[model samples]
Target chain A: MSITISNISKSYKNVKALQDISFEVKENELFGLIGPDGAGKTTLFRILTTLLIANEGTATVAGFDVISDYKMIRNSVGYMPGKFSLYQDLTVEENLNFFATIFGTTIEENYDLIKDIYVQIEPFKDRRAGKLSGGMKQKLALCCALIHKPKVLFLDEPTTGVDPVSRKEFWDMLKRLQQKGITILVSTPYMDEAALCDRIALIQAGKILEIDTPKAIVKHYSKPIYNVRANNMYQLINSLNDYEYNHSVYPFGEFVHYTDKRADFNQKELKMYLETKNLTDIEIEKTIATIEDTFMELAK
Target chain B: MKIILYIIQKEFKQIFRNKGMLPIIFVLPLLQLVILSNAATFEVKNIKFGYIDNDHTSTSRTLVEKFNASTYFDVLTDFPSEGLASSSMLNGEVDVVLEIPQYFERDLQKEKYNSLGITINAIDGAAAGVENVYVTQIVQNFNQNLKVDLLQVSDKQIQPITIETIPLFWYNETLNYKTFMVPGILVLLVTMITLFLSGMNIVREKEIGTLEQINVTPIKKSQFIIGKLFPFWVIGIGLLTIGLIIAKLIFDVPMVGSLVLMYFYTSIYILVILGIGLFISNFTDTQQQAMFIAWFFTVIFILMSGLFTPIESMPEWAQILTEFNPIKYFVEVMRMVMLKGSSFIDVLPQIIKTFLFAFIMNGLAVWSYKKTT
Candidate 1:
């Protein structure tokens, strides 16, 4: 395992940011910490990356203890923080050179490591980081982080606030890095990105609810799930929430992914119930579970 | 060391690239040095004088002429009545008012002694006290002149044992206030520039999110602190050099000692100031908070550093409080070396105190900073 976090807990005064979070990320694995905002994803990432100290338990990254061997971990890992943390006043080329040099290497020595990502921004080499668009800034930050050719990489919400197309391109870059034998640990609030990871952990409220491959995590959900929709979406939602045995009701895209606690639950009965509420054009169908369905099931 | 050099290189590049900050760092200190040096002075001049001379005797007239003759007093007017002189004093037209009673000259002739009623504006207590001294000195000179003019072999002529003493002001002859203030003000400018820059620089990085990147790196805390402070240290030294040049060319202020020694003291002193600033930076989250804290300490340090007031003249407790101020030692060293031509031994005590201060403060800076909390 490249990262082994055992019973890690942290609190900020009165708020318990992370509590007894335990997980392991294997070598060269693109592991994803999947959760919504404030779900302890960042707290875990910060602890494992050696930027924070966990109050209870231990974390080892690259076989180095987070506290005792922080220097070793710092040297072996690259972190692109949740925010764009590169010097905003520096030009693109200057920023890249500065980070590379500080890590005791030159840009020429690590040209190949950052080439694919740097080429897109090579044209704006003289542009100050602050002036770049959100996507461009993300690309530059990644290049700076990777310039050292780290053994493991930690990306904290790298795709937040990025355009979808640019977000796809960033994931592609991470995949290429993994092919180079670099273990990647990335966190994101977007559920669909979970499928891009080798294994995923569903996390919420300072605890991990499930950890498994995206496909397996979905299969791990034992409940029968349904997609319910109607011409009056809002009224339909209220009617279904008022259903006698509905387990969970959350909107997914144009439909609501729902489950019911009734063992003999019938979709025919649900549709009949919505019709009496003056809802028309109803669509109900059994759907295969995805990571989103699995996460909602476990989080609740 | 290489990592530190890279950090320093990056810092210099950022500093030079900031167009708005270049003039502020390079030109503003020298400007303040020249303009403020003229304004900050202890030498009291231009004391406005008005007196009521009811007797109108030669002695009283001589007293007024004596006041007019002294460069310290302007001798604005002679009021016929005490009421008129009091009115002038209330209007703020005169700083000192001398009231000679109707029998003033007769009293001196009969009683062999006379007292002059002198009222002074004490709003600026220091200036008022200094003006009183100047008036007493002129009156004493007139008393001697009276003895000679009277040609008295009387009982008063027994000749009180008088010791004639000549005061000689060395180093800064003519006692030009600028000569004394330029070096002190230069120290303040150097201090303010380095402190504000170092204090704000790290906090700004924290705000912009770059400090997190630096923190997660494998760089040592001491190395990072050194790298962060090196640029401002150079800037502080650069300011001192420029200020010294201006003091030489414009103000004709003397630098009788070794320039190399001054630079050496400043190099160590800059570390103390930069260390304090970085400590403030590490504690604060935003540049505004950092600035407020830096300004608070800067104002306190400057006021108590003996820049405007003499440390020796302050109350015993206040003087002891100044002992902890690095600026106080620096001001003393700058003047001792620049004006007095003091060699290494002459300034050894100040240098040692500053060295210890720099050591303690920078140690505190490094100890207080934490990459992982």
Candidate 2:
């Protein structure tokens, strides 16, 4: 195992941020923790990176204890914080060189690792880091973290505010980094990014809802889902709930995705029942479950 | 160590690139050294005086000539009466006035005793007192001269008593206020620049979200701090060097001490300032708050550092309070090295105090910096 966490718990003054959370990432696995804001993702990443100490239990990165062997863990792992955290006044080249020097290495020693990404922004290396575009800064921060060729990489919501195109490019770069035999643990709020990871943990309110591959998690969501749209969508949903057949009804964009509570509920009866309410343009079709669907089901 | 060099290089680049602040850090200190130095002197000149010559005789005229010949006073106007002379003194036009009574020479010849009226402005009491001494000395000299010329034709002898006082000023021969103020002002400039720059550096990173990125890195806390402070330390020394050069070229201030010794003390002094800047950086979260707090303490330090006023003249409590001020030691060492050409042994106490302050401040800064979980 590249990372091992057991019974880890942390809390603020009156709020528990993480409760008995335990998980492991295998060597060279692209693992992800998927959650919305305030789901304890940053807290957990901090503990795993040895920047924070766990109040209970133990975590080991690369076979070294996080607290007792923090130096070893730091030397072996790389972390990119959720926010852009690099020296702004320094030039891009200077920032990279400084971080490399701190880790007892040089740009020439690890040039092969970051060359693919650094080259794209190499022309503007002399520009101050503060003046660079967000995407360019993101790339520079990544290069600094990877300059030492660590065994595991921890990135906490690295693409939260990035543009969609930059977000896609960032994930593509992560894929290439994974090819270099480095274990990567990334966290994100976007459900779509869940499928790109080897395995993912769905978290809510500081608790894990599920931990499995995206496809497996979706397959395990045993429910009949339907996308229902009508001229009067609100009335349809409210009336459907009263019919005692609705499991859950939530608006998904312009249409409502509803699941049946009873395994034997008939769709034809539901359609007829909606028509009796004088609802026009009614369309009800069974749809495949997605990671978001599984997450909502598990959360509920 | 190599990381520290990288950090130092980065700091130099930032300071040089900041166009708005470059002149403020480099040029303002030199300008202050030149302008404020001229205004700080204790030597008094161009003292205006008015007189009412009631006797209007050659004796009174000779006394007036004596006053005019002296460098301390200038006869601004001759008042027709004592009322006019006293009114001019009240209106602040004249600092002193002389009233020669009627028959002053006749009484001096007959009774060998006469008193002339002398009134003086008492505000700024010290300067007024010094001027009074100068007036008395000139009058006594005139009395002796009169007795000598009278004795040439009479069968009598006149004996005059005189007191001679020799003043020996140590450390500064000419007592040029510029030589004293330049080193002290340089200390203030070094402290202000380093404290503000280093205090703002980390807070800027925090504001822009880059501090989080550094936290995630595998670097140790000590390494990060050393990297951050090393650069500002270099910049602090660079500012000192520029300030010294300007002080020499423009003000013609003598650097009597060894250049190597100045550099050595300056390096240690900048370390103290860098440590202070780092300590301030750890306490503040925003650049504005950091600047305000830095500015607040800087005002207090400059006022209490004995730069503008003598600490010995302050109240006993205030004098005791200055022992904790780091600027006090810096100013003391700079003055000792530059003006007195003091050897390392001569400034050992100040050096030790500053070194201790540097150690404690930097230690506190590192301890306060937390890698947030």
lDDT of 2: 0.84
For candidate 1, give the docking quality class from DockQ. Answer: medium
Residue range A1-300, candidate 2, lDDT tens digits: 999989999988788999888888999999999998999999999899877787898999999999998878888888888778787778899899888887889999999999999998899999988899999989998998899999999998989889999999999999999999999999999999999999999987788888898899999888988898999978987877777768888778788888988888787898899998888888899988889888888888
List ranges where model 2 is wrong by over 4 Å: A230-247, A260-282, B40-160, B202-212, B215-224, B363-373
The interface root-mean-square deviations, each candidate in sequence, come to 1.3, 2.6
- Best model per lDDT: 1
Q: Can you write out model 2's per-residue Cα lDDT over B1-373, one digit (the tens) per residue?
A: 6766665576667778888878877777667766766776666667898888888788889999999998888988999988888888888999998888999878887777899898988898877888888889989999888887655444453454667788997877777778888888888888888888888887877787766656655656676777777777777788788888878987777777787877787788777777777777777789998899899989998999999888999899999899989998888888888888888888888888888887888777777776232
Most TM-score-accurate candidate: 1
Estimate the TM-score of every prediction: 0.92, 0.82
> Residue-wise lDDT of candidate 1 within A126-214, one digit each (tens)?
99998999999999999999989999999999999999999999999999999999999999999999999999988899988989999
Q: What's the residue-level lDDT of B188 in candidate 1?
A: 90
